[model samples]
Target: MAYKFALCLTLPHNTTKMKKKTIILLILAAIVGLAQFIRPDNIKKYENGVKTEDLAGVPKEVNEILRNSCFNCHSSSSELAWYDKITPVSFLVASHIQEGTEVLNFKDWMSMSIAKQKAVLYYSINKIRSGEMPLSSYILAHPAAKINKNQMQVLEAYLLSISARGKTDSVKLKALERDHKWVKPALNGIAYMPDYRNWKAISTTDRFDNGTMRIIFANEVAVAAIKAKNINPWPDGSVLAKAAWTQEIALDGSVSTGQFVQVEYMIKDSKKYAKTEGWGWARWKGDDLRPYGKTINFTTECISCHRPVRENDNVFTIPLNLK
Candidate 1:
């Protein structure tokens, strides 16, 4: 009788524990089911269709590779997988597509100048070679988007074939030497600072599209801000200079600087430059140092190109850390 009583009491306690577990599982299931109804706004509805005519000059093979690897996020014709439509995952997918298009939109391809198109291709090639594109998270779900080595070689060859080599102009060179001391100010009133050549080089870049190499130099104010890790706004009076030169390729495949191309400057003064994103933008092209714009509105192009990096104060170069 005593053993029977103890057994009966334990059965009720075990039943209560099982009932609590069942209730907890049902609540979790309900939460997951309800979450499925909370979907993000479809980003595709607002996008324009990408037509073949928009990519008129692109070779078919190159276009195929770009469409397969890049268009899903960079263009309007994004192909979302079934799993990508899930609530949380769909939100992430939409965010990625939005950011990608903001950085480089294929829909704007035909609208860009031929020179700008080439520059975009060069920049894209660099990102692909570095494996910084197609995003690892994205590639995980869509393996077909990963660019293969053969595709990479094809893109590289096309870029090289289109790049024009710099030609020598002795008369122009002589004139440039003679007029070295009389460079003019930009249309927006930013003066040419020839002494930027003496500033410390903070970074270097190559423009394969134009067959040019560039060196970025920072003024003392910029350098100090960089060292102090306070360069987001780049303190007032900070100046940066980017000088470019044509690249001369030797028979042995060696490359060296050839002719001067242009030099651009960015001077930070938040209050003074409030209308131009807190920086005075200027560019002087060629060895003769001719100002690059007919009107002050030319700064509009610079502002647009740097808009994607607004979080970084519209600055692109990340300065090297000082020892």
Candidate 2:
């Protein structure tokens, strides 16, 4: 009887081990299957019709570092990675590249006005300092992209130098100012209108950073309680207006100047208008609103992501853009 009991216990142990093995194998299979769906895409290599020239004065070390670590996403000629060919991973990689390049494309660096370029570089420094660059998850996969303390210092120094140069380039400054004219309007708290500018509706998004606010304006008729009726008959051509602003809190608990500002228009099948679907953000100086930059950070979609802020009418901490 004792021998029989031992046999029974041993058999169960073997079965348990086999079951654990099966689970692990299944998980691995899922990961592989998901990878197959993420085919690598070389879509970001499009030319922007901008002229490229030698960086005669740029520090070789800084240029090289950026080329290897940042250009992959921040430049138009990003080198495709081996894993980027797979499915889900490819999607994520493509998203990151799109976002990165939109925010600051090195290949299009010459295309920006000097002032805009300086502003972007400053923002880049802040982004890196805040541990937001090379994105932590990205570094995990490509260890070579990791920036050590020394490398970070080099990058910061390079940005400072570039900013100084950018300020002196008046021609570039004028060009950039025109592109980012929305900053002037937002600073004075003016209502954005399509009539004044060739503005059109764009996508929306809901995920906003702290002390930021966004608003979406659309034809009230288009909204038409369609959700209640379980109908979405609104023409996809109907435009949605969107704007976003980032704010900072003063030491006295009052809101300071706008940290960022943006405006765009979009079209969507759904009647809802918010920043979460897709939008853009401006890079405004925290201390002073006059100094500003531009970004395509999907400000339109900011509202949809912040479901928790629906109590505030889907707005975050930013005050209303218009009275």
Against the true structure, whose TM-score is highest?
A: 1
Q: In order, how many clashes per candidate?
A: 0, 45
Off by over 4 Å in 2: 12-20, 23-31, 38-57, 80-85, 159-323
lDDT of 2 by residue, 1-323 (tens): 99999999899999999999999999989988876854545553422323333333358887777777787778766565777645667777777888887877787655454555567667766887888887998998788888789988897878765555545765544544555324343322222333312332222344445556555555433244232331133344344455566656678977543544644433443334333332222223332234232333334334446457655333333322221
After superposition on all CA atoms, what RMSD does each candidate show versus the true structure?
Answer: 18.5, 18.9
Q: Give the C-alpha lDDT of model 2.
A: 0.55
Error of 2 at 221 (Å): 60
Q: Relative to the true structure, how large is the alpha-carbon lDDT of every model? A: 0.83, 0.55
lDDT of 1 by residue, 1-323 (tens): 99999999999999999999999999987876787787667554423344423364678889989988888688766767777777678788888888888899887776554556678999999999999997999999899889998999999988876664554443433443443445668999888898897899999987889899999999999998888999988999999999999999999998889999999999999999999999999999985578998788999999999999999999999889964
The candidate scoring highest on lDDT is: 1
Model 1 lDDT, full chain set: 0.83
